[model samples]
Target: MLSDPKSRFKPTSTAVADKSNILSALKQPYSNAARIAGTMRNAYLTNGSVSKVIDYYQSHPTYNYNIYPVLGNKQYELNDNVRNSYIDIAYYLRDLNIKFFAPIFFKETLIDGVTFWYKYQDKDGVGYMKLPMEWCLIRGTENGVYRYMFDITKLNDETVQSMPEEFQNAYKEYQSNNTSDTNTWYNNKYYYVQENGMAFTFDYNSLVNGGLAISPFASALTDIISLAKAKDNVNIKDNLDATRILQQKLPMDKKDGEMLISAKEAMIYDQTIRGRLPEGVILATTPTELENIPLTNSGTANAFDTVNKGLEQVFFSMGGSSPLFGGSTTSSNIVKEGIKKDANWIYANLFPMLENYYNSEIATVKTKDKLLWNIKFIRQSNFTLHDDIMNLKDQLTLGGSRTDYLAANGFIPAEIISKLTFEQQALDIDSLMVVKPTSNTLSAKDAEIQKRGRPKTDNPSDDTDRLDDEQG
Candidate 1:
């Protein structure tokens, strides 16, 4: 009998408390940093244009990595623990929620300028949870030395209970020490100080505004507000246009060059228009005629176009191109080339930081396992695969070392050569292969000419007939 499908893997639990509510309730009046980070996070979650740019990076290929042995002039025996740790790291990353974390990572690093991950050990070795931006407070002077303040109240009672004994005891102590003044108590006790390595923080850019990174979307917020207002105006106009108004012209008397109508008669007409007309109707008595008027004209028809233009500005502000949205955009090639440039930038700037982080974290794990050889990480991704392949081709053509190129392509040249040699000898396949004529090997025509002794005169054209005669 087959086992239950749920038994195949470990179950994951989510936090029960509403973090937004906690932030709203516990937020200090002096700081808008949490609110600003919340806004940026919410914009990424709710806005299509913003999400699209982040999604492009989030959906980018997971890194391909190699663990290289780094032994510096020291005689060390490579043990099974050292070798297996590499496999353990690979599996841990594979099982981790990288797809979910990647978008948050990109959003924080690129826009918010900092990101935090709560690292913990589990049955799967190590796991990371992306901490809420609003609940996180950056403290300390230097960027490297800065510690993160994570609000413990953001986690519900169930989550707190599920935590380890140390965190549980802290939470209980906080609960016992709670006071009437929520602000002071919350500010001082609710926030748990996460030490440097315990909580992973990537502070890629310079900090500002009370150690809070300014959002890239801050400039585009005005444009977004304008777009919203414009959309509202357009909707209002459309609603007005949807209802047709009736125009009634009562008979008027021209007395002393002045058009006049009885007030009673006008009141009666108004009453009739209001009662009998379907909706959106008005009555007026005048010497001239009256006609139903439309709310807009060709002059004001560009309202929607203006909205589109504003949207384009917002897209650019969000570090995205119009072509990324992919609807009748003429710049597919532009965005494609831009993607290449982005990949290059990521490799140059962002990847080094990630490499350092992983190397340090995994080294700690390996040390616990009594591993001797220190492992170095080499990260690659499919984003630059085409360029890498082209460069490799060019280099090989220019007489680059095959061993180096093969290693780059993730091959062992010695193993490959050994396998080829085995096939050549054991299978004897080389004996059956036909050799093609090269400059060193004489061709059939040249051999025949050489055998017949080069033409005495300028009778090279007759060599074919002579060869045929010689064959006969």
Candidate 2:
């Protein structure tokens, strides 16, 4: 009975089922099982589930608009918790880069191995400015080949008009080609110019996204920032709801009674006396009474603390210590150490990447025979002045020359050190020089006598001599 295709299998005293029959039912040539399996396989192969998810994320209209305006354009803005994180990181990175590797123009010949360094300057005397790495958008494939780079340039009407004709034309052409696109460079929008006028669209040997470079925080930042914003919204709504609850009045007494005043009269009474009640005014009320509302004291158990934890997570994800975003004036030793660790990590990883990108751009402008010099980024140490001073003292004590020690400690510029040495020598000579009083030098008494014409008398008294000196 079980083997029969028309029979439905059921547990009974006489019922029996075998593996062979079950297998036959499942694998039958014309059975519905094969059709169901084939359908699932086709769906998997076609990525039907994945496509639906992606479509929901990409095609949804609500996701396309910015929810917050104060933070800037929603597409480019981060959540409040991590909103300023990128800006802070970018600022530090840009400052460090500028401090260490403000571009220097150099020419090198391959044959003689001779190199000449020149201060970087534009022919127009506007000064050669290196674009900050933080302001650039790097996009590339998975193979470390940079495909497209965008330099974020803020141009106003006057500045745009003042730009060179070649740059203006190129910018206008770009705008004309991309007018329909939201990312176009019209008006105050960002403009993308070719690096050093090179036609090559891709940069080679870039570690992130083929050749396009990006902030270290770019990958994990968006989700964390969004989560933080969501938390803040939830917190605000919760607090508002709690406040509303607190504002509601509770019934103190229950009595079925008709009001002495009509609805219109009550409205008039409220409008007149709601916020303008005079002191000591009393109204007789026996049947109807209203109770004062009490505030609700719902404990905010760890809600804000959770938000803080999320912020810490964001900072950590961005290669920063939690204390950096803790908004505290002071931190513990552990936090300081964590910050130092993060700094070292950035120096080792981020600075080198940026340096390499700049070097690649620099190479493009160099002639074939001119050896390209890679710019070096100096990572500023967190050592305090005390540390440097102590180190300087130690070096001096260890027989290091004063000039070398001072130079190594960066106490004075090399050019000014010579002048300082000359001044020190002059001061030493002045200190060493001393004139001995000669026997012919006039005494105070003799000088007074000479000034007062040898006093009034030959036997001048002590008081008379002093008075004469004073008079003289």
Candidate 3:
């Protein structure tokens, strides 16, 4: 019998006490970082035109200023995490960064083991959950210490029932447990945990106004939005310019006026006769009277070019290059070099942060001992096979050793190259010997006679005649 697909992955919930009042008491400044990040994401996905992007930003300026950290966090998430972890920390960081700009990771000791949880705000009004970095907040900072906050309303009856008996018992004890301070419940309010050095707070050097990190793109995006609106205005103006109305001055006579009106109506209806206008209506007019209205300006083409340039600048400000997002593929070497420089700048800023996070949080004792935490950003190679081969040849010709060339191209280890070189030397030595021809080998004359049956007679025609006589 076949099983139901829905039954295989069941939804579970947990019951937990409400902590809204307690959470509200420790409220941090509200930042619309998530909204800005979401807008950027949408713009990139839809390839939003200047007008659309500007309109969105203008209507939500406060929201727009909060997106930089979110964007930076996402970049970190993408470049960090080369190895797949059990929890996929990169994925969680990406989600949090997109939604909250300020992503936080902290460890929690559960009944089963020590697990990490991402801070996210819960949709359910009851309270937050000990979930992945889905929805949560930085409640507030007291002195130099920061208290990470989350609500337990996300824990439902179904979730508890699914837990192992030991875990369930541990969870119950955890809920009932009280903090050292008598004023707060252990599970109901924000508590200060020692920073394990693994927690990340991606602010991107943003100005802390009212406890919210202001986005770096905020000022630059204003100009981009304006440009977008201007481009739209130019398009609208161009469309208006394309529209031409033909005006003809008719004679004051009622009959001629009537004929002109009829002709105009015919043209309007797209039903004008192929070769003739209405009778008495003349097609001929003075150059001054029948001139086309010029709608396009001399600089109309340049206006569009300017808009394109503005768009490229916007992309650059957002930590991207023109070539990255379907810009010119066959750019000049200087342009390509500029793109590499930009990429390196991003790497320089992002890689260190990722490395620190990995070293503090993700790196286990065993992994550290094995030196597995040394992170490297995956760079896209630009060299083709032919280019690589030419480079290798040039290097080798410049007196570089075979081992160095092979290792540089990642073809083989130095030890293997040495072994192969030794084997090749042996083969060359063996091939140096040459054997003399044996007596059994036929001479050129003997080989030709064998091929042609017998040697031809000096008088070949007479031989042919003799053969013919014998046959006869």
Q: Pick the candidate with the highest TM-score.
A: 1
For candidate 1, give the lDDT: 0.52
Relative to the true structure, candidate 2 reaches a TM of 0.39
Q: List clashing residue pairs in candidate 1.
A: none
> If the candidates were sorted by their lDDT against the true structure, best first, what order would they fall in?
1, 3, 2
Candidate number with greatest lDDT: 1
> Each prediction's TM-score against the native?
0.58, 0.39, 0.38
Residue-level lDDT tens digits of model 3 in 1-472: 1233433212131211123321332243124433333333333344464323333222211110010112242243433323333124333322333213211121011010111233222332111123222122344343322334333343445654543343344345457764345233244443323233112333432223322332334333444554556577677767655544444443344554344345555454443332345443334321234665455562366667777787777766554455644567575664556555644543454334434543343243232112233222222123232453466568687785554344334332323434455666866644555443332443435534444323334334643532222224
> After superposing candidate 1, which stretches have Cα over 4 Å from the reference?
1-30, 73-104, 107-115, 125-127, 139-147, 152-159, 162-166, 173-211, 240-242, 247-291, 296-299, 324-333, 367-384, 392-472
Instruction: Kindly list the per-residue Cα lDDT of model 1 for residues 1-472, writing each as its tens digit.
Output: 1223433212121221233433442344125444444555565665666667766665454443334455545636566665455455545544444444544555566544455555666565444555445555555432234445555666567666544454566576677765334433346554545432222334433234443444445555555556655666677667666666565665555565443667687777778667776555444544466655665442346678877887788777665667657634665688777667666656665555555555554454444345533222223346556566567567888895554444446433233344666779887877777664443455556655555433323345643443444645
Candidate 2 off by > 4 Å: 1-97, 100-164, 171-214, 218-258, 273-293, 323-333, 353-375, 383-472
lDDT of each: 0.52, 0.36, 0.37
Q: Which 10-residue window of candidate 3 scores lowest in summed lDDT?
A: 60-69
Rank candidates by TM-score, best first: 1, 2, 3
The lowest-lDDT stretch of 10 consecutive residues in candidate 2 is 106-115
Task: Give model 1's TM-score versus the native structure.
Answer: 0.58
